[model samples]
Target: DQQVKQNSPSLSVQEGRISILNCDYTNSMFDYFLWYKKYPAEGPTFLISISSIKDKNEDGRFTVFLNKSAKHLSLHIVPSQPGDSAVYFCAASEGRGSNYKLTFGKGTLLTVNP
Candidate 1:
């Protein structure tokens, strides 16, 4: 079973619109949640994160909400721009410890058309 899954492999939206990405996890032990954005070849860069302690976290143009009971998380980008076109990955890990290993979902590729 996939511990983490991004059901949509890709999303496309017009520029200056809202882009939403969804993610789901089955592991209840995951306490740290993160979202990363990746360009063509470079590694993913951290976008935002929310601990199991919080239900929401937001960055400049990005926002993440976590629903612990449902084991679901979503990323929202308001007024999405062309630069936002890339693959987004949802990651999860346990609290800092030896067992802490970052697990990533396949990814959702978002394309913003101008």
Candidate 2:
């Protein structure tokens, strides 16, 4: 059973628009949620993260929202630029020190039309 799931396979948006990516999890043990962006051939690079204790976290143009009660989370990119077009994977893991492994979604391919 996949713990983390991204229902949408892809998303398209204008270069200056907002991109919203959704993610869901079935495991309640997950205490941390993260979003990673991957290029065509490059490794996934971490974008934003939120702890179970908080409902939201923001970094510059990226914002991550977590709804622990529903086991749901979302990543929002405002004014998405052309370079922001990439595959985004939502990952989850337990708290630090438990040596937990991350569970990742299939990924959503984001296309920012120039």
RMSD of every prediction: 0.9, 0.8
Candidate 2 structure quality by residue, lDDT tens digits, 3-107: 999999999999999999999999999999999999998999999999999999999999999998889999999989999999999999976776878989999
Global lDDT of each candidate: 0.95, 0.95
What is the total number of backbone clashes in candidate 1?
A: 0
Q: Which regions in candidate 2 have their CA more than 4 angstroms from the true location?
A: none
> Least accurate stretch of 10 residues (summed lDDT) in model 2?
94-103
Clashing residue pairs, candidate 2? none
Alpha-carbon TM-score of each model against the true structure: 0.96, 0.97
What's the CA error at residue 43 for candidate 1, in Å?
Answer: 0.9
- lDDT for each residue of candidate 1 in 50-110, tens digit (9 for 90 to 100): 9999999888889999999999999999989999999999999967788688999999999
Whose TM-score is greatest here? 2
